[model samples]
Target: MENNQDSRQRFAALVREHSHSMFRAARAILDCDADAEDAVGEAVLLAWQAFPNLKNQQAARCWLLKITVNCAYGQRRGQRRVVYMDDLSQAAGSAPSPEPSGLWDAVLRLPEDQRLAVMLYYYEDLPVAEIAKTLGVPQGTVKSRLSRGRERLKALLREEEAYGF
Candidate 1:
Protein backbone atom coordinates (compact mmCIF):
# COMPACT_ATOMS: atom_id res chain seq x y z
CA MET A 1 0.00 0.00 0.00
CA GLU A 2 3.01 2.26 0.44
CA ASN A 3 3.68 1.96 -3.29
CA ASN A 4 0.09 2.85 -4.04
CA GLN A 5 0.37 5.94 -1.86
CA ASP A 6 3.58 6.99 -3.62
CA SER A 7 1.98 6.53 -7.02
CA ARG A 8 -1.00 8.62 -6.05
CA GLN A 9 1.26 11.37 -4.77
CA ARG A 10 3.26 11.39 -7.97
CA PHE A 11 0.11 11.43 -10.07
CA ALA A 12 -1.27 14.35 -8.11
CA ALA A 13 1.94 16.30 -8.65
CA LEU A 14 1.81 15.61 -12.35
CA VAL A 15 -1.82 16.65 -12.49
CA ARG A 16 -1.01 19.98 -10.86
CA GLU A 17 1.79 20.57 -13.34
CA HIS A 18 -0.39 19.87 -16.38
CA SER A 19 -3.73 21.19 -15.14
CA HIS A 20 -3.55 24.49 -17.05
CA SER A 21 -2.79 22.76 -20.32
CA MET A 22 -5.59 20.28 -19.72
CA PHE A 23 -8.03 23.15 -19.10
CA ARG A 24 -6.92 24.91 -22.27
CA ALA A 25 -7.33 21.76 -24.34
CA ALA A 26 -10.72 21.14 -22.81
CA ARG A 27 -11.80 24.73 -23.47
CA ALA A 28 -10.74 24.33 -27.07
CA ILE A 29 -13.16 21.45 -27.39
CA LEU A 30 -16.03 22.59 -25.18
CA ASP A 31 -16.02 26.33 -25.98
CA CYS A 32 -17.27 27.34 -22.52
CA ASP A 33 -14.93 28.25 -19.69
CA ALA A 34 -17.18 26.85 -16.96
CA ASP A 35 -17.74 23.65 -18.92
CA ALA A 36 -14.01 23.29 -19.54
CA GLU A 37 -13.34 23.57 -15.82
CA ASP A 38 -16.00 20.96 -15.16
CA ALA A 39 -14.40 18.67 -17.74
CA VAL A 40 -10.97 19.06 -16.15
CA GLY A 41 -12.41 18.30 -12.73
CA GLU A 42 -13.99 15.12 -14.05
CA ALA A 43 -10.82 14.14 -15.90
CA VAL A 44 -8.70 14.55 -12.79
CA LEU A 45 -10.99 12.31 -10.76
CA LEU A 46 -11.08 9.65 -13.47
CA ALA A 47 -7.31 9.84 -13.92
CA TRP A 48 -6.65 9.47 -10.21
CA GLN A 49 -8.78 6.33 -10.09
CA ALA A 50 -6.82 4.93 -13.05
CA PHE A 51 -3.39 6.09 -11.85
CA PRO A 52 -2.27 2.53 -11.20
CA ASN A 53 -2.58 1.80 -14.90
CA LEU A 54 -0.11 4.51 -15.92
CA LYS A 55 3.19 2.85 -16.84
CA ASN A 56 5.33 5.71 -18.07
CA GLN A 57 5.15 8.88 -16.04
CA GLN A 58 7.08 10.62 -18.79
CA ALA A 59 4.00 10.41 -21.00
CA ALA A 60 1.71 11.73 -18.31
CA ARG A 61 0.93 15.01 -20.04
CA CYS A 62 -0.31 13.40 -23.20
CA TRP A 63 -2.22 10.83 -21.20
CA LEU A 64 -3.90 13.51 -19.09
CA LEU A 65 -4.80 15.50 -22.19
CA LYS A 66 -6.48 12.47 -23.72
CA ILE A 67 -8.58 12.10 -20.61
CA THR A 68 -9.40 15.81 -20.64
CA VAL A 69 -10.59 15.73 -24.23
CA ASN A 70 -12.71 12.71 -23.54
CA CYS A 71 -14.26 14.36 -20.52
CA ALA A 72 -14.95 17.50 -22.54
CA TYR A 73 -16.81 15.42 -25.09
CA GLY A 74 -18.75 13.75 -22.34
CA GLN A 75 -19.64 17.14 -20.86
CA ARG A 76 -20.84 18.35 -24.23
CA ARG A 77 -22.97 15.25 -24.62
CA GLY A 78 -24.41 15.62 -21.15
CA GLN A 79 -25.55 19.19 -21.62
CA ARG A 80 -29.35 18.97 -21.72
CA ARG A 81 -30.06 22.31 -23.27
CA VAL A 82 -28.35 25.09 -25.20
CA VAL A 83 -29.12 28.65 -24.22
CA TYR A 84 -27.95 31.47 -26.43
CA MET A 85 -27.19 34.59 -24.51
CA ASP A 86 -26.36 37.92 -26.11
CA ASP A 87 -24.57 39.18 -23.02
CA LEU A 88 -20.85 39.36 -23.82
CA SER A 89 -19.38 40.99 -20.71
CA GLN A 90 -19.05 37.79 -18.72
CA ALA A 91 -17.17 36.02 -21.49
CA ALA A 92 -15.06 39.04 -22.40
CA GLY A 93 -13.39 39.03 -18.98
CA SER A 94 -12.19 35.45 -19.51
CA ALA A 95 -10.41 36.07 -22.79
CA PRO A 96 -6.83 34.91 -23.22
CA SER A 97 -3.94 37.22 -24.14
CA PRO A 98 -4.17 39.21 -27.36
CA GLU A 99 -2.09 36.91 -29.59
CA PRO A 100 -3.57 33.73 -28.21
CA SER A 101 -7.08 35.17 -28.24
CA GLY A 102 -6.97 35.82 -31.98
CA LEU A 103 -5.50 32.42 -32.72
CA TRP A 104 -7.73 30.70 -30.21
CA ASP A 105 -10.92 32.14 -31.64
CA ALA A 106 -9.81 31.02 -35.10
CA VAL A 107 -8.99 27.55 -33.82
CA LEU A 108 -12.38 27.33 -32.10
CA ARG A 109 -13.98 27.89 -35.48
CA LEU A 110 -12.23 24.88 -37.02
CA PRO A 111 -13.74 21.41 -37.30
CA GLU A 112 -13.54 19.34 -34.12
CA ASP A 113 -10.75 17.00 -35.31
CA GLN A 114 -8.64 19.85 -36.66
CA ARG A 115 -9.11 21.99 -33.55
CA LEU A 116 -7.96 19.05 -31.40
CA ALA A 117 -4.93 18.34 -33.58
CA VAL A 118 -3.87 21.98 -33.52
CA MET A 119 -4.34 22.21 -29.75
CA LEU A 120 -2.33 19.07 -29.04
CA TYR A 121 0.44 19.99 -31.44
CA TYR A 122 0.88 23.73 -30.91
CA TYR A 123 -0.55 24.32 -27.43
CA GLU A 124 0.76 21.17 -25.75
CA ASP A 125 3.85 20.75 -27.97
CA LEU A 126 3.27 17.02 -28.34
CA PRO A 127 4.94 15.28 -31.29
CA VAL A 128 2.99 13.91 -34.22
CA ALA A 129 3.17 10.29 -33.14
CA GLU A 130 2.11 11.15 -29.60
CA ILE A 131 -0.77 13.24 -30.93
CA ALA A 132 -1.85 10.42 -33.20
CA LYS A 133 -1.77 8.01 -30.27
CA THR A 134 -3.65 10.41 -27.99
CA LEU A 135 -6.26 10.99 -30.68
CA GLY A 136 -6.33 7.32 -31.72
CA VAL A 137 -5.89 8.27 -35.34
CA PRO A 138 -3.28 7.52 -37.98
CA GLN A 139 -0.31 9.90 -38.25
CA GLY A 140 -1.51 10.78 -41.74
CA THR A 141 -4.89 11.75 -40.41
CA VAL A 142 -3.36 13.97 -37.75
CA LYS A 143 -1.15 15.63 -40.33
CA SER A 144 -4.12 16.24 -42.57
CA ARG A 145 -6.00 17.88 -39.73
CA LEU A 146 -3.06 20.15 -38.92
CA SER A 147 -2.69 21.22 -42.55
CA ARG A 148 -6.36 21.95 -43.00
CA GLY A 149 -6.59 23.71 -39.66
CA ARG A 150 -3.74 26.03 -40.56
CA GLU A 151 -5.33 27.00 -43.85
CA ARG A 152 -8.61 27.73 -42.15
CA LEU A 153 -6.96 29.72 -39.35
CA LYS A 154 -5.11 31.86 -41.88
CA ALA A 155 -8.31 32.72 -43.65
CA LEU A 156 -10.11 33.39 -40.40
CA LEU A 157 -7.36 35.64 -39.11
CA ARG A 158 -7.36 37.55 -42.38
CA GLU A 159 -11.05 38.11 -42.07
CA GLU A 160 -10.70 39.25 -38.48
CA GLU A 161 -7.97 41.68 -39.45
CA ALA A 162 -10.09 43.13 -42.24
CA TYR A 163 -12.97 43.57 -39.84
CA GLY A 164 -10.68 45.37 -37.31
CA PHE A 165 -11.51 42.87 -34.59
Candidate 2:
Protein backbone atom coordinates (compact mmCIF):
# COMPACT_ATOMS: atom_id res chain seq x y z
CA MET A 1 0.00 0.00 0.00
CA GLU A 2 1.16 3.57 -0.73
CA ASN A 3 0.40 4.59 2.85
CA ASN A 4 2.42 1.67 4.17
CA GLN A 5 5.39 2.71 2.03
CA ASP A 6 5.23 6.30 3.26
CA SER A 7 4.84 5.19 6.85
CA ARG A 8 7.86 2.93 6.57
CA GLN A 9 10.02 5.72 5.24
CA ARG A 10 8.86 8.13 7.91
CA PHE A 11 9.48 5.57 10.63
CA ALA A 12 13.06 4.98 9.49
CA ALA A 13 13.78 8.69 9.42
CA LEU A 14 12.33 9.14 12.89
CA VAL A 15 14.42 6.27 14.23
CA ARG A 16 17.60 7.88 12.95
CA GLU A 17 16.60 11.19 14.46
CA HIS A 18 15.79 9.81 17.90
CA SER A 19 18.12 6.84 18.25
CA HIS A 20 20.16 8.53 20.97
CA SER A 21 17.07 9.48 22.94
CA MET A 22 15.74 5.95 22.85
CA PHE A 23 19.12 4.58 23.84
CA ARG A 24 19.38 6.95 26.78
CA ALA A 25 15.90 6.05 27.99
CA ALA A 26 16.75 2.39 27.66
CA ARG A 27 20.01 2.83 29.54
CA ALA A 28 18.30 4.66 32.39
CA ILE A 29 15.51 2.13 32.70
CA LEU A 30 17.53 -1.04 32.27
CA ASP A 31 20.41 -1.47 34.70
CA CYS A 32 22.93 -2.93 32.23
CA ASP A 33 24.09 -1.37 28.97
CA ALA A 34 23.57 -4.61 27.13
CA ASP A 35 20.04 -4.83 28.43
CA ALA A 36 19.54 -1.23 27.41
CA GLU A 37 20.66 -2.04 23.88
CA ASP A 38 18.23 -4.91 23.77
CA ALA A 39 15.45 -2.69 25.05
CA VAL A 40 16.12 0.01 22.47
CA GLY A 41 16.33 -2.57 19.71
CA GLU A 42 13.03 -4.09 20.77
CA ALA A 43 11.42 -0.67 21.03
CA VAL A 44 12.42 0.23 17.48
CA LEU A 45 10.83 -2.95 16.21
CA LEU A 46 7.66 -2.33 18.14
CA ALA A 47 7.53 1.28 17.01
CA TRP A 48 7.75 0.32 13.37
CA GLN A 49 4.98 -2.18 13.84
CA ALA A 50 2.85 0.49 15.42
CA PHE A 51 3.75 3.27 13.01
CA PRO A 52 0.30 3.58 11.55
CA ASN A 53 -0.99 4.78 14.88
CA LEU A 54 1.42 7.66 15.11
CA LYS A 55 -0.50 10.78 14.09
CA ASN A 56 2.19 13.41 14.44
CA GLN A 57 5.72 12.75 13.26
CA GLN A 58 7.06 15.41 15.62
CA ALA A 59 5.95 13.33 18.56
CA ALA A 60 8.28 10.53 17.50
CA ARG A 61 11.01 11.21 20.05
CA CYS A 62 8.70 11.15 23.03
CA TRP A 63 6.81 8.21 21.62
CA LEU A 64 9.99 6.27 21.02
CA LEU A 65 11.30 7.10 24.48
CA LYS A 66 8.08 5.81 26.00
CA ILE A 67 8.45 2.56 24.11
CA THR A 68 12.10 2.27 25.06
CA VAL A 69 11.39 2.91 28.73
CA ASN A 70 8.47 0.52 28.78
CA CYS A 71 10.48 -2.19 27.09
CA ALA A 72 13.35 -1.74 29.57
CA TYR A 73 10.93 -1.73 32.50
CA GLY A 74 9.35 -4.90 31.21
CA GLN A 75 12.75 -6.51 30.89
CA ARG A 76 13.64 -5.49 34.43
CA ARG A 77 10.41 -6.90 35.77
CA GLY A 78 11.17 -10.31 34.28
CA GLN A 79 14.88 -10.40 35.04
CA ARG A 80 16.37 -11.81 38.26
CA ARG A 81 20.14 -12.01 37.76
CA VAL A 82 21.94 -8.97 39.06
CA VAL A 83 24.73 -7.56 36.91
CA TYR A 84 27.72 -6.94 39.14
CA MET A 85 30.36 -5.28 36.98
CA ASP A 86 32.85 -5.07 39.83
CA ASP A 87 33.14 -8.82 39.90
CA LEU A 88 34.88 -8.83 36.53
CA SER A 89 38.59 -9.47 37.16
CA GLN A 90 40.76 -6.94 35.46
CA ALA A 91 44.43 -7.54 34.87
CA ALA A 92 46.70 -6.81 37.83
CA GLY A 93 46.70 -3.30 39.27
CA SER A 94 48.75 -2.29 36.24
CA ALA A 95 46.02 -0.06 34.87
CA PRO A 96 44.43 2.88 36.67
CA SER A 97 40.68 2.74 37.34
CA PRO A 98 38.09 4.07 34.93
CA GLU A 99 36.28 7.31 35.77
CA PRO A 100 32.88 7.22 34.07
CA SER A 101 31.98 3.83 35.47
CA GLY A 102 32.48 5.13 38.99
CA LEU A 103 30.22 8.07 38.21
CA TRP A 104 27.64 5.73 36.79
CA ASP A 105 27.88 3.52 39.83
CA ALA A 106 26.81 6.46 41.94
CA VAL A 107 24.08 7.34 39.49
CA LEU A 108 22.82 3.80 39.46
CA ARG A 109 22.64 3.79 43.23
CA LEU A 110 19.95 6.49 43.09
CA PRO A 111 16.27 5.69 43.56
CA GLU A 112 14.48 5.01 40.27
CA ASP A 113 12.50 8.26 40.17
CA GLN A 114 15.57 10.31 41.01
CA ARG A 115 17.73 8.41 38.54
CA LEU A 116 15.21 8.93 35.77
CA ALA A 117 14.80 12.59 36.57
CA VAL A 118 18.54 13.22 36.73
CA MET A 119 19.17 11.42 33.48
CA LEU A 120 16.40 13.22 31.63
CA TYR A 121 17.35 16.59 33.05
CA TYR A 122 21.14 16.34 32.74
CA TYR A 123 21.94 13.72 30.15
CA GLU A 124 19.00 14.35 27.84
CA ASP A 125 19.09 18.06 28.58
CA LEU A 126 15.36 18.17 29.04
CA PRO A 127 13.57 20.90 30.97
CA VAL A 128 11.52 20.19 34.08
CA ALA A 129 8.20 20.52 32.27
CA GLU A 130 9.28 18.09 29.55
CA ILE A 131 10.61 15.65 32.12
CA ALA A 132 7.41 15.88 34.12
CA LYS A 133 5.37 15.19 31.00
CA THR A 134 7.56 12.27 29.93
CA LEU A 135 7.52 10.79 33.43
CA GLY A 136 3.80 11.47 34.02
CA VAL A 137 4.72 13.45 37.13
CA PRO A 138 4.43 17.08 38.15
CA GLN A 139 7.11 19.64 37.34
CA GLY A 140 7.73 20.11 41.05
CA THR A 141 8.54 16.44 41.38
CA VAL A 142 11.11 16.76 38.62
CA LYS A 143 12.72 19.72 40.39
CA SER A 144 12.92 17.84 43.68
CA ARG A 145 14.40 14.77 42.04
CA LEU A 146 17.04 16.80 40.25
CA SER A 147 17.92 18.67 43.43
CA ARG A 148 18.25 15.57 45.58
CA GLY A 149 19.99 13.59 42.87
CA ARG A 150 22.53 16.36 42.34
CA GLU A 151 23.26 16.64 46.04
CA ARG A 152 23.78 12.92 46.38
CA LEU A 153 26.04 12.81 43.33
CA LYS A 154 28.10 15.67 44.69
CA ALA A 155 28.70 13.78 47.92
CA LEU A 156 29.36 10.42 46.31
CA LEU A 157 31.59 11.59 43.48
CA ARG A 158 33.59 13.90 45.72
CA GLU A 159 34.34 11.08 48.10
CA GLU A 160 35.45 8.86 45.22
CA GLU A 161 37.50 11.37 43.20
CA ALA A 162 38.63 14.04 45.68
CA TYR A 163 41.72 12.31 47.05
CA GLY A 164 43.67 12.81 43.84
CA PHE A 165 42.70 16.40 43.16
Candidate 3:
Protein backbone atom coordinates (compact mmCIF):
# COMPACT_ATOMS: atom_id res chain seq x y z
CA MET A 1 0.00 0.00 0.00
CA GLU A 2 2.75 2.39 0.87
CA ASN A 3 4.59 1.49 -2.32
CA ASN A 4 1.48 2.26 -4.34
CA GLN A 5 1.15 5.61 -2.60
CA ASP A 6 4.75 6.43 -3.33
CA SER A 7 4.33 5.49 -6.99
CA ARG A 8 1.22 7.59 -7.28
CA GLN A 9 2.97 10.63 -5.82
CA ARG A 10 5.88 10.15 -8.19
CA PHE A 11 3.51 9.75 -11.13
CA ALA A 12 1.51 12.80 -10.18
CA ALA A 13 4.62 14.91 -9.97
CA LEU A 14 5.76 13.63 -13.32
CA VAL A 15 2.41 14.46 -14.85
CA ARG A 16 2.55 18.01 -13.50
CA GLU A 17 6.02 18.40 -14.94
CA HIS A 18 5.24 17.18 -18.45
CA SER A 19 1.49 17.46 -18.87
CA HIS A 20 1.71 20.46 -21.17
CA SER A 21 4.09 18.79 -23.59
CA MET A 22 2.06 15.59 -23.49
CA PHE A 23 -1.09 17.53 -24.31
CA ARG A 24 0.60 19.25 -27.20
CA ALA A 25 1.77 15.96 -28.59
CA ALA A 26 -1.65 14.46 -28.07
CA ARG A 27 -3.30 17.47 -29.70
CA ALA A 28 -0.87 17.20 -32.57
CA ILE A 29 -1.73 13.56 -33.04
CA LEU A 30 -5.50 13.80 -32.67
CA ASP A 31 -5.87 17.40 -33.91
CA CYS A 32 -8.50 18.31 -31.37
CA ASP A 33 -8.21 19.88 -27.97
CA ALA A 34 -10.82 17.66 -26.36
CA ASP A 35 -9.39 14.45 -27.71
CA ALA A 36 -5.94 15.60 -26.74
CA GLU A 37 -7.07 16.02 -23.16
CA ASP A 38 -8.71 12.63 -23.23
CA ALA A 39 -5.63 11.03 -24.72
CA VAL A 40 -3.39 12.54 -22.07
CA GLY A 41 -5.72 11.30 -19.39
CA GLU A 42 -5.79 7.83 -20.85
CA ALA A 43 -2.04 7.82 -21.19
CA VAL A 44 -1.70 8.76 -17.56
CA LEU A 45 -3.84 5.80 -16.62
CA LEU A 46 -1.90 3.41 -18.80
CA ALA A 47 1.39 4.79 -17.62
CA TRP A 48 0.40 4.08 -14.06
CA GLN A 49 -0.53 0.54 -14.95
CA ALA A 50 2.82 0.03 -16.61
CA PHE A 51 4.77 1.93 -14.00
CA PRO A 52 6.09 -1.33 -12.65
CA ASN A 53 8.15 -1.71 -15.79
CA LEU A 54 9.72 1.70 -15.53
CA LYS A 55 13.44 1.32 -14.99
CA ASN A 56 14.78 4.81 -14.42
CA GLN A 57 13.25 8.00 -13.05
CA GLN A 58 15.14 10.01 -15.63
CA ALA A 59 13.21 8.38 -18.47
CA ALA A 60 9.83 9.13 -16.91
CA ARG A 61 8.96 12.14 -19.08
CA CYS A 62 9.90 10.46 -22.33
CA TRP A 63 8.12 7.30 -21.31
CA LEU A 64 4.96 9.16 -20.45
CA LEU A 65 5.22 11.17 -23.64
CA LYS A 66 5.54 8.06 -25.77
CA ILE A 67 2.53 6.55 -24.05
CA THR A 68 0.49 9.70 -24.57
CA VAL A 69 1.36 9.83 -28.25
CA ASN A 70 0.48 6.20 -28.70
CA CYS A 71 -2.78 6.68 -26.86
CA ALA A 72 -3.73 9.66 -29.05
CA TYR A 73 -2.76 7.82 -32.19
CA GLY A 74 -4.68 4.79 -31.04
CA GLN A 75 -7.82 6.78 -30.48
CA ARG A 76 -7.51 8.44 -33.88
CA ARG A 77 -6.66 5.18 -35.55
CA GLY A 78 -9.69 3.49 -34.09
CA GLN A 79 -11.94 6.18 -35.42
CA ARG A 80 -10.44 7.41 -38.61
CA ARG A 81 -11.78 10.47 -40.46
CA VAL A 82 -14.02 11.79 -37.73
CA VAL A 83 -13.76 15.57 -37.64
CA TYR A 84 -13.71 17.47 -34.37
CA MET A 85 -15.61 20.73 -34.39
CA ASP A 86 -14.49 23.67 -32.35
CA ASP A 87 -16.35 26.87 -31.45
CA LEU A 88 -18.38 28.62 -34.12
CA SER A 89 -16.98 31.86 -32.76
CA GLN A 90 -13.51 30.81 -33.82
CA ALA A 91 -14.61 29.63 -37.22
CA ALA A 92 -16.93 32.54 -37.82
CA GLY A 93 -16.06 35.61 -35.72
CA SER A 94 -13.37 36.24 -33.13
CA ALA A 95 -11.38 33.73 -30.97
CA PRO A 96 -8.29 34.46 -33.09
CA SER A 97 -7.56 31.07 -34.71
CA PRO A 98 -6.14 29.12 -31.79
CA GLU A 99 -3.39 27.29 -33.64
CA PRO A 100 -2.22 27.79 -37.19
CA SER A 101 -4.19 25.30 -39.25
CA GLY A 102 -1.47 24.89 -41.79
CA LEU A 103 1.04 23.78 -39.18
CA TRP A 104 -1.34 21.42 -37.40
CA ASP A 105 -3.09 20.29 -40.52
CA ALA A 106 0.20 19.36 -42.12
CA VAL A 107 1.35 17.62 -38.96
CA LEU A 108 -1.89 15.68 -38.73
CA ARG A 109 -1.54 14.60 -42.33
CA LEU A 110 1.84 13.03 -41.75
CA PRO A 111 2.24 9.25 -41.64
CA GLU A 112 2.50 7.80 -38.15
CA ASP A 113 6.27 7.35 -38.11
CA GLN A 114 7.01 10.80 -39.42
CA ARG A 115 4.42 12.41 -37.21
CA LEU A 116 5.95 10.82 -34.12
CA ALA A 117 9.41 11.91 -35.13
CA VAL A 118 8.31 15.46 -35.86
CA MET A 119 6.40 15.78 -32.59
CA LEU A 120 9.27 14.43 -30.51
CA TYR A 121 11.80 16.58 -32.29
CA TYR A 122 10.01 19.90 -32.66
CA TYR A 123 7.60 19.86 -29.74
CA GLU A 124 9.58 18.06 -27.08
CA ASP A 125 12.98 19.23 -28.30
CA LEU A 126 14.26 15.71 -27.89
CA PRO A 127 17.45 14.60 -29.56
CA VAL A 128 17.29 11.96 -32.26
CA ALA A 129 18.79 9.33 -30.01
CA GLU A 130 16.28 10.06 -27.26
CA ILE A 131 13.39 9.98 -29.71
CA ALA A 132 14.67 6.74 -31.11
CA LYS A 133 14.95 5.36 -27.62
CA THR A 134 11.43 6.43 -26.67
CA LEU A 135 10.09 5.13 -29.97
CA GLY A 136 12.21 1.98 -29.86
CA VAL A 137 13.36 2.69 -33.38
CA PRO A 138 16.78 3.29 -34.81
CA GLN A 139 18.28 6.77 -34.85
CA GLY A 140 18.51 6.55 -38.64
CA THR A 141 14.78 5.92 -38.88
CA VAL A 142 14.06 8.91 -36.68
CA LYS A 143 16.26 11.13 -38.86
CA SER A 144 14.68 9.90 -42.05
CA ARG A 145 11.18 10.40 -40.71
CA LEU A 146 12.01 13.89 -39.45
CA SER A 147 13.47 14.85 -42.79
CA ARG A 148 10.56 13.48 -44.79
CA GLY A 149 7.93 14.83 -42.43
CA ARG A 150 9.39 18.35 -42.50
CA GLU A 151 9.56 18.32 -46.28
CA ARG A 152 6.02 17.07 -46.58
CA LEU A 153 4.76 19.63 -44.07
CA LYS A 154 6.44 22.44 -46.00
CA ALA A 155 4.85 21.28 -49.20
CA LEU A 156 1.46 20.87 -47.56
CA LEU A 157 1.61 24.34 -45.98
CA ARG A 158 2.50 25.86 -49.34
CA GLU A 159 -0.29 23.92 -50.98
CA GLU A 160 -2.73 25.00 -48.30
CA GLU A 161 -1.77 28.62 -48.78
CA ALA A 162 -1.98 28.31 -52.53
CA TYR A 163 -5.34 26.54 -52.45
CA GLY A 164 -6.56 28.41 -49.36
CA PHE A 165 -7.03 25.80 -46.61
**lDDT of each model, Cα atoms only?**
0.87, 0.80, 0.84
The candidate that wins on TM-score is 1
Candidate 1 pairs with clashing backbones: none
| Cα lDDT of model 1 by residue, 1-165, tens digit | 458678778888998899999998898888678889999999999999888888887888989999998999989998887664533544667554344337877888889889989988998889999999888889999999999999999988998888777
Worst 10 residues of 3 by lDDT: 80-89
- Of 2 and 3, the candidate ahead on TM-score is 2
Query: Mind giving the per-residue lDDT tens digits that candidate 3 earns over 48-97?
Result: 89988898989888889889978987898887566445565567777666
Report the Cα RMSD per candidate: 4.5, 3.6, 4.7
Q: Rank the candidates by TM-score, best first.
A: 1, 2, 3
Runs of candidate 2 with Cα error greater than 4 angstroms are 83-106
Model 2 root-mean-square deviation? 3.6
lDDT against true structure, model 2? 0.80
Clashing pairs for model 2 are none
Candidate 2 vs candidate 3, lDDT winner: 3
Q: How close is candidate 3 to the true structure, as a TM-score?
A: 0.72
